[model samples]
Target: MTTKPAIIILSASALAMAARLATELDGEVHGLRKRIGDDAEVTFDDVAAHLVGLFREGRPIVALMAAGAVIRLLAPHLGDKTREPPVIAVAEDGSAVVPLLGGHHGANEMARRIAGLVDGFAAITTVGDIKFGVALDQPPEGWALANPETAKQVMADLVAGASARLEGDAPWLADSALPLSEDGGIALLASDENVNTPVSGLLYRPKRLVLGIGCERGCDPAEVLALAKESLSEAGLSAEAVGLVASIDVKADEAALHHVARHLGCPVRFFDAATLEAEAPRLINPSEIVFSEVGCHGVAEGAALAAVGASGELAAPKRKSRRATCAIGRAPHPFTESDLPGRGRGRLFVVGIGPGSDGWRSPEVSQMVAASTDLVGYSLYLDLLGPLAKGKVRHDFDLGKEEARVRHAMELAGEGRSVALVCSGDAGIYAMATLVFELLDKADGPEGLSDGARRIEIAVSPGISALQAAAARVGAPLGHDFCTISLSDLLTPWEDIKRRVRAAGEGDFVIAFYNPVSKKRRTQLAWARDQLLEHRPASSPVILATNLGREGETIRVVPLGDLNVDDVDMLTVVVVGSSNSSTVATGDGRTWVYTPRGYARKEGTAMTNSFSGDAA
Candidate 1:
């Protein structure tokens, strides 16, 4: 069974039962925020909606709820079986477990595991799964079936106690636990050839080939794709068997190469010049011209061998066109995505988890965190992630130890582990993403580390920024131009911060002040107000939003002159409106702060088609 992390969704009453299963399976527990999930790291307001989202995200769900409830929740979002995420619902009392979806994609196995833990029966429905103890469609990790339609009938034949010859060169299939009848009508053919499936047989395609491509600087994507398809067809190689498309690192970002790979439905892999050159002696046709241009004699041949490793041999030599060349390499064994290193580049996700609230966080941030193997952040930020950090190896540091935290994350990514350097709110805004690039700029490049850490891939997954949350709490105070300046002088100079704040004031821009004040730094907020007062009116709307999207959250708007510096803290994001801003009292006697997008001048002019119907 694939050991992917699971999301355990249970009710308030079943928290105790969930605790045992969650620990056993290393699942993230989710329950109602006010009722259950006190023991869970994350809590939800709507259990069914949250479960639906998690299921779509491909997370293995262990729903400890009624089967009817699980079905009702998933009814609307149920998609193709090929794309559905695994979902298994267990009885609240741990008496019955049902695999509701993605059985072919491991739901059956997950259900069985869950059932065993609860000492209950797993209601497995697939007869082929129970009888032959296998799913033919689910080949071994490195293999795939070319046509699943034929595999269905063959599976039925196996379930009905009929098996014919295991054709081609797959020993595992020959020795399969399937009931063997030497001359039975059913058959399973494993090969890379283009096969026409018979009435009683299935064609299994082994992921054993790598296609290496070399192209001119601006090769046409269509031509490259056509070449790839035609070459595969002429060579009698199934496109499904091509595990990857590889080329030299110089073509790593080549749009044509990527387009061709995408059109062929295979992942693109790249080898550095040095790695490709090392495979020179094995190239069928070495060329001095090609070597001079790309530092490699044969990009197609070298990359193909490198992708498939030492045991692989070239199935076809480089076939040339005016603008592109191609070669095919066959691996001794089938290759899985894990077996092929597309590039030896590690990935680092600099994520912002938002203001410690699951509802306020973005789906992208959640997925990036889930995909990461390691979580790197300040202790508080990691703690805020709750159960999202459950299975990840967390490297937590104190508040100000950002350099250590970021460096540790980069180094972990260098070792080819998917690392998430998490932060609160937007990572680019006064967070770790900028610091990550700064360190990379100073490195001696990838050669600095024995494992080449500088080549580590970095991405920034944005969160619902504090200013955005604060702005939306009231009316749109930031509907017009706005600028943000941090009041903290830890890394930035106080004078520089003041200059930015002054510019915002002079431009009549709405200003959001981050890290406004701490215990020791008391005077900056007051000083900023005085500086802003020089340009604007004293009655300007000042929104003090503290602990946004978190417990004890408070959002209140007061006049600029009434703003108390002592009331602000590092957790607060204070949005000060521009000169055009205004405050209005609603029916409930609550005032809303707003800065018009551009309609302040146009408001009095009015319109002929006004909804209030005052056409004069």
Candidate 2:
């Protein structure tokens, strides 16, 4: 997958140009913290460190700075040209654009694209691009080079005044400035087959072949892979020519199908049963058994025909192994992922974006949100995503529609779209992860999860929870054993909430109260505080954390006896210290709370042992 570029700016002066580029390229803006304002999506404290990090993440970098500066910053990290992403430098005033590295691997093209947007000059320095207006080693989209090592010598020979012969159709090469002749010194062969070309020639594989697959639930990955390879070998087709691995949507999460795609180094796509059934007339081996099983007459043949469209033909008929079937289809022209009709395996990422700050959000959560096609959550939670939410199809729900939000996300993923079910804090805590599973467990009864929904791959990415954020803001109130209880009587009965609070007091465990209070539910906080006071002293510390990581953030420590319900709200998390917890006033005039974990007893024992040894 191609990642969106990171437009890095150093000062506010470049913010305007960076914004324009970001919009044009569909990229994100990263700026220096103090120099740039809120217009920049992300802020960085260090430039070199940030650039290196983006480079390592394999994200293209478009720095609106001097070319020399970017070159110097990325010099040490420049080793593998093949593995590096495009790095471009654009003049802050939008006058000049330079491709600093990865010239063949998209840097040159990106620089030219930016220059076009700014009406500036793209400083393309690659000799192949300048001479023939094409890079043989780095073919355009929908084409793969079989022998890249031969490109360097061939280009050298061409530069030394050698003519080339075109074996097959390739408009980009034929239209270039390359000197072509019927019987030239070098041959450029473009074919979808695994052919034996001349030693001095270049073999280019056009992406016109589709590998359609079908397998049992627990089919061995090796068996599927071997069958696919054997089918391609018999058809005289190259693996590099395989554009897509397609199957029924019901097998979206099948391990064997994914393994086949990975082995062929191609993306896997899926078609709904109804869509596949439409291609049943064209199937070479349509079966009624398959129609009864999956609502499709043929899994392999029908999927292959659907991918190739009406103008194409099957290169190979259905070939079956022990538990898997494979078929190949050839399209009239090369295609990309966007040209296909169906989607890939759907993925539902239940992600926790952390409290609110970008710093607190986990990198894994950021990556998942970035990769998702749609975002589903409460409006406030989706808004907290900030720049990460840009360009995504958002499905916002009201505060009270938790079940509706999860159901919508699951259904969206069932349609072969990548959906992110957004949540606050850790998703597995009291968030939507549990609700998602609950609905899935009851799929047969009331929730009625579709087969496609059940087949989607589900994952949970943990985030920094509210309890951890509150404890970090304060001292070590959670240093000892602790338990969390929700004081909201809406879900659980008031008697049950009070019982848990009383049990926590009897156990002398530090308690963190979630959903502490609402407008109509103010008495629960006060009641919990009174119950905890009966066991611990009235002077025990209680930390009230409101808007933990967002605006109007406040952290206050008060005596348990002085805690009032008016000071708490639904947004506040109340943490009451245990009986052994103590508050100490440090030299900095800050009061820190901590509970002893019995380390003092170990220290005293060690001292007594040393004294006894001295006396003996």
Candidate 3:
């Protein structure tokens, strides 16, 4: 779960308190629309549905309302308490803080923290927290509860005046106010072993082990996972003890390494070659061949030592399958995410923001932009992100620098930074997604990508393209067979483009023309218009959608015979209808274009009659 909570306020009265909490918690304020001013980060019309949606997404929520109201809204969705995120209800006047759900999962702590900030009382009602000052079911970070089902009975006994004894090394628990005795009735065992002796008390596993892995390019994920499990079995260490998976930076994009980390239920971190090579003296099986390939003497063992720090030791020697290697390092104590030194595997999210409109932008694109540490795009594309662009490192490029933007995004990710390469409309349609792969495909050429850049993970999140937006506004222009063609001859030869246009026209495909015209380039759109008229009727409907999903947007339809190059620009998408397409005037005196997909042929068929009867 994210550390940043969602501070939800329902009225203007709670706006000041919500703003204070948001600033203190590094959270975003979600306010009720029209009830609060623009000071809130986001405004929603429906409070109950929005709160439930945030709860379902596992985001911690700090709602400034009555505790009963929050409970009433979320009562129907409540089930597993273990999986629910922290839900706290703070009074609108900031006088009281009540943890209504997930009391053991940081809710109580957050309540107390917020109460202290507002000079109010923390109404923590959990018996175990009040008596022992610790939640046995939900242990601290980097510690896993081996048997959580037994925690309720154990906590009940402890709350019923039964003393407990600590049986292992746990510095955090040692400071808690639990009634500890040598011969107590209940025992708390903390160990890295896979204990399965039906303990009478809670069994916790301290995550002190770091699993290091390395594999050849395109290694099998199953092979790496099996080797990791076998190495853990041989070392007598529990999988719960693995706090992190470490590897050299060059294997950051390796599928097998990520698969193993997922199987182990831990995050994966990567060290650069220089950092991994610093542990050469401690590698159990150093190899010069490994150094020649990835600049590290031993990928598995060196990464393990590099992650475990100098005081740690190699708990398990290097083990290998056919194409993968695994090693284990043990720290003296459990470690959390902040304790790890190396950066996580870099990821490049190539996302399309969808024509400068928040309504047209997809939720996935918004999430990708939120998760990114750096935003790389043309200046206009980045500006379209609005509130989501706050606090992100922006790298703006001018027009005609497509290769430069992609290369810079890849380089930033190679250094273990989360990057978002922003584009307009759909990322896969005439956008940066193709350029990213083009560079990756030529990673070994004279002016190719760096070794680290070649290994960064890349994902493309699509958005509504200009063709789809234009087609939707004009009504069904792309409902039938269609193709998209770019008219710019800067990258491709004009002869080839003309060949595609002629083929599309002959094939009776509705064509959406992109890059229809530029300031210096002309005659292409007019020539194409004339060429398309040869195959189709001169009365064919042609749509010129300009500045779609933005200010000063215009959608105009003209005949194929009247399609002048002066009406088209770089921002306009020209859609020429097929030979069989038609336009009709509605009752409201508006023109609607549509291409019939042979539905009229089935009008008298039995299948159509049966569907009509079913609808009736």
Error of 1 at 554 (Å): 4.5
The digit string of per-residue lDDT tens for model 1 on 1-616 reads 2234454555567877777887887666677776763566557787777887777777788888788888998999987778887788888888998998888888898788888888999999987778766788877666787778777777876776676777788766766678766676777788887777656687788878888999998898877877877778888888888878899876754677778767656777788889989899899988899999989899988988888888888888888877998889898888776667557346799999888788777778877887788999988889888777777898889988888888889889876678999999999988888988888877766533323456676788898889999988887888789989889998799999889988889999999999899889999999999999899887788899989888899987777877799888778899988887877667886667777767756856631211111100
Residues 327-383 of candidate 3: C-alpha lDDT, one tens digit per residue: 999988777877776888778999998987766887678778878899999999998
Q: State each model's CA lDDT, in order.
A: 0.80, 0.88, 0.87
Q: Which pairs of residues collide in model 2?
A: none
Looking at candidate 3, what is the lDDT of residue 540?
83
Q: At residue 252, what lDDT does model 2 achieve?
A: 89
Off by over 4 Å in 3: 1-3, 9-19, 31-49, 65-69, 215-218, 284-297, 320-324, 583-591, 604-616
Point out where model 2 deviates above 4 Å.
Answer: 584-588, 595-597, 604-616
Using all chains and alpha carbons, the TM-scores for the candidates as numbered come to: 0.81, 0.93, 0.90
- Model 3 weakest lDDT span, ten residues long: 607-616
lDDT at position 584, candidate 3: 66
Residue-by-residue lDDT tens digits, candidate 2, 1-616? 3388999999888888898999999898999987875567777888999999999888999999999999999999988888899999999877899999888889999999999999999999899888888888899889999998899999999988999999999988999999899989899999999898669989999998898899999999999999999999999899899988889988888999888888877788888899999998888899999999999999998888888889988999999999999999998888775686568778899999889788788878888998899999999999999888988999999998999899899989988889999999999988999999988898888658888788788999999989999999878889889999998887799999889999999999999999998878778888888888789887778889999999999998887888888888789998888877777666776767777775546745431101111111
Predicted structure with the largest TM-score when compared to the true one = 2
Which of the two candidates, 1 or 3, achieves a greater TM-score against the reference?
Answer: 3
- TM-score between model 3 and native: 0.90
